[model samples]
Target: MWPLPVRPERSYSGEIRNFSKLFGTERNRFGSLHKLTLYYLPIAIFVAVYVLIILRNLRWFRIPVWTIMMAGAVAMIFSGAIPLGDAYASINLNVIFFLLGMFSVVAGMDLSGLLEYLTLKLLRVAKSPQKAFGLVLIGISMMSAFLVNDTLALMATPIMLSVAKQLRIRPGVFLITLALGVTIGSTMTAIGNPQNLLIALSTGIPNPMLDFLYYLAPPTLAGLGVTYLILRWYYRKEFANSTLAQLQVNPREAIKDRKLAKLSGWAAGIVVLGFFLVGIAELFGIQGNFNLGTISLLGATIVFLGSGRRREILRSVDWGIILFFISLFIVMQAFWESNALQSLMIYLPVLNRSDPGLSLVTIILASAFFSQLLSNVPFVAVYIKAMQAAGFTGADVKAWMALAGASTLAGGISLLGAASNVIVLEEAESRGSGFGFVEFSKIGLLVTIPNLLILYLFLRVL
Candidate 1:
């Protein structure tokens, strides 16, 4: 166990108790109120913030999700749920820098139109709606495994919309397909999404990329196939009579700047190669201090130096998401320190440390349910701490992998379950075409059940 930091006498709780001694007659009442405020306030703030996030698109009270989380963080600080220094320490700079680097590289790719060129090339082979649907499902899923789901969602939204229009079919189905594809595909790699990254970095997984592939790749691929069949069956009417239009477009012509595209492509390739090399080396029992963040940052440096559009790429990085992560760390840390989460955990199913099978089901079920309430990233952040506290160590590979898979698949449970889902929705809304909450949840529920079952079965047997 890690040693606890030494606390001085004048700590927050000490002050509360000291103050209560002065008002001896009413001390009991006063102390009770203070104790309640200290312990439960953070939980209340967390729930309120998430509620506001769910209702963020309400017409009369529009607010950004980041702002809500930031507010909760500030409230936690001022309320003394956590010390200011601890709050700062809680933010994971590795995750932040990794995201920053990736967003920049992706921005470079999008700006150069290389991503679009490649996407079109992949989609152009479809001569009918069913072929296009399968391609979008499989193609986007494969890309998301390496590129990150949220990034792919942002880049693929408009393209899916365009494809829907060309084929004279509703964009809603394609957009839903895009959302499901990314969610399922991202399950295969540590760097595929933020939650998976959190599990990889926090759990001390020796070869996160390879471990994820060995355990999750099979289920992820199976989930994609299952998702494709489900969507085809569900939207049978839409796919039954549709044929692709002769898209008079050339994929090569989509590239705006050949020089930048080449540079960006090289940068992306090097980053992916670095990830695999590091993982392979670890697998062979060679120890080195390589991490996903450093490799990604290296890729970003290459793009910044080779491409002249550094400023544009920097601007394109999702600053709001960066801010959200920062604030989320603070808030979640405060929540954990408050001891409320620990108290609440007693009421939940106990993870059987001796029995991997029962523990797997417990972890997956809890992760899927809570992820819908707290979202996958934040849920994973706190759950990692919980698992460690429960005596789960780095050597517990199966347990950690289960957490990663179940938490990620949880995103397909509802519209608010994943940040990528929100990104796709916001992008589609900006284009004046979007899916409804109910519409998304309906499809999400159908897709998540079988995908989760596949994940469980694969993890158990493999």
Candidate 2:
């Protein structure tokens, strides 16, 4: 019925409709193929890609880091090298659920303006910039000990930047300090990072969260103190002059909605308490065990329904990161199939399993060194199975914990060592602030060397 001039548009719309129908109909087919690829072809491609990346130096290619990691995961699946994929599947589900739940809780809090309120309150309570900085660092660190470091980093970075901007100081120092503190704090709890999750999932350790807290609390606090001391020693002059005199704190201005803040805080507390209850249930060997994923999803649902802001909370979720992890799981699964990991394990003489203490030290040091070169997340992933196979005992666990501390904390060792460092640098560049790698290193080394020594003593002698 359309005129000739409108016929083309009508035809186009018809074609689009047909295409959509076809695509929808075939969507399951594509999904099945994707699963097949992950299960079957993972080993071959993983080996090929890994060699290309490492030996041929294809890292400069435009491919995303997540893509490469996914390839590695697929390789793991095919090789069956881990022999624990089934187990890890359950673990991953739980972690994803827990993350989802925590994210929902945090999202509710964010919407409620609790973070803003807390920041302003703390700023008001502190006497000076230095004291404020210390308080912020400590608070974020403590929170991150239980929460996801990435979440903490992502949330805190923007607030820090805003505060720095208002204070008329270079945002670099504040941003970098917060990022590093978050990373350090993440190591304090078992649920803080992917590495901690992997360690807990793969190990037979009972009450991993509690056990980690017990083992890591003292050392982590010591590390924080050492960091403060080192920073003072290295940046004493800067610290003295750098005061947030211009920064003002007004709780009413900082928080847009006090009533919402109160509600969100209460909800968040409930969710956190739920987490504690889950842990307690596990500790007491409760027969009716709830899946962490289910709990997390349930918590998220509750928050969404209770707050009547489902869209906002959903928007805050990092679906890209989630997909990245799923892809990574597939790649790792493939890596296992290719027997590549087993071969690598054979060559790494450090995992001799004969001298567990030495091996533990080696792993920790090696992780720290390589993390400085590559990255801690990937380094942790690559070495996890090997370390476990190396037959670590109670002392080995202590050593591994120390190693995790070093690997994560030493992220400040250089600009390239930590993603957080890079993020801070990018922000500095945007603000036209001069934050060079060399300068950061000078500040970082003062903290790193002593921390390493302290970790060594803790793992070896203590």
Candidate 3:
């Protein structure tokens, strides 16, 4: 079957007749809605797998998320919901390789003991329990602005569990603060997280790093303050009258292989520089199309070659999550091809020349629950595409900025809101301390709603 639908050439009158069914217009093109019903079977299969996967913890069957998503992708292809060529086209290789490269680099950092070193250093600086919690929060926030927060969360959570035991601090506060800070600081920079990276790469964002810092940093910083207060308020007894338990840990002991560390660190530097120089250099008469994925892959190659145990570090690249993202890209494209997102254009006011404040508010409100419903990354992809169809182009600087701000901020709205939160929860559980979905949401609401409201007001005045 052809990957793209073949539509009959119709006059204005005929098109007007089909206007109400635009998103599902395939029915009209096929001559009957019944003929197109089976094409949507993949959606049902995908939804069933999705629901069951989320319930895996209830039973002893521990199926990975990647498994379910890939099953959906395969089912869609087999059922002709998405053609083979369309499925291939739907996967964004850039995002996949970008994630793999970053994961490889962080895996090297793990080999060099950098994660342990940084985690220990952050813990040693606190003089008391309150100071410790605050210090940890700042460290996580700062680290997330540049490094991948998921990597940080995976490595840091175990160390934090150790801190919880020694310092007698509540594991809930320490873990939750880490989750909050990771989400908040990620909004400060495009490179901090995946959603930001996607927005930065998509057209309409100018000077990604500079633009984010200037516009998003203010509210994100403010939100961090709110996160701190709410956490302290909720965990007041946990933070009060705490003794400084000198860490029995020494970071130096972990660095038997400094050679891999230095190589990984150098590779990270090169990749970061490459990201900044990619398109900016073109403005200065340098002619080349540089991509973050290729450059980061180069960094990964460097680490792989230098590290003697390439197989071991390569094995740790979170391949499951990467595959999950790839399958997700394809499944999401089905919705896009069906014009499901384009239909949202009508609800959104014209973003090209609309009031900046109103546009910001609309994007924020829509992205908040939208993200929770389908996850932030998918929502951003659909939202950005929808707005572009609605006349919000790269020239609409405010629109894209609003998207980056609202999408990233809204990722903290619930437990399913962001990958980092889920990572922390899963990782914490492995270490014998983790909260349920209800507790996470209860804590999240205490800070998220108020912070989002303040940001809405702040944007209105700006």
Candidate with the greatest lDDT versus the true structure: 1
How many backbone overlaps does candidate 3 show? Answer: 1
State the RMSD for candidate 1. 9.7
Name the weakest run of 10 consecutive residues (lDDT summed) in model 3: 31-40
lDDT (Cα, tens digit) per residue for candidate 3, span 304-400 = 9888979878888888878887787777666556544544566544554466776777787887877777667756766777776676777666567
Q: Local distance difference test, per candidate?
A: 0.86, 0.65, 0.74
Tens-digit lDDT string for candidate 1 (1-462)? 999987866658776877767677487787777777678887898778767876776688788878998999999989888899999999988788788888888888888998888878877787777887898789889988888789889988998888888777788998988998899999999989989988887788778889989999999998999999999989999877677764544789889989889988999999999999989888788866666888889899999998888898899888888898899889888888877777756756687778999989999999999888778987787788778778888888889999999999999989889989989998999999998899899989999999999999998998
Tell me the TM-score of model 3: 0.83
Model 1 global lDDT (CA atoms, 0 to 1):
0.86
Report the lDDT of model 2 for residue 454.
66
Q: Work out the TM-score per prediction.
A: 0.88, 0.78, 0.83
Which residue pairs clash within candidate 3? Answer: 204-394
Please list the residue runs of candidate 2 whose C-alpha ends up more than 4 Å from where it truly belongs after superposition.
Answer: 1-44, 47-64, 70-91, 257-260, 291-294, 346-349, 352-354, 392-396, 423-434, 460-462
**Sequence-dependent TM-score of model 1:** 0.88
Model 2 TM-score relative to the real fold? 0.78
The best-first sequence of candidates by lDDT reads 1, 3, 2
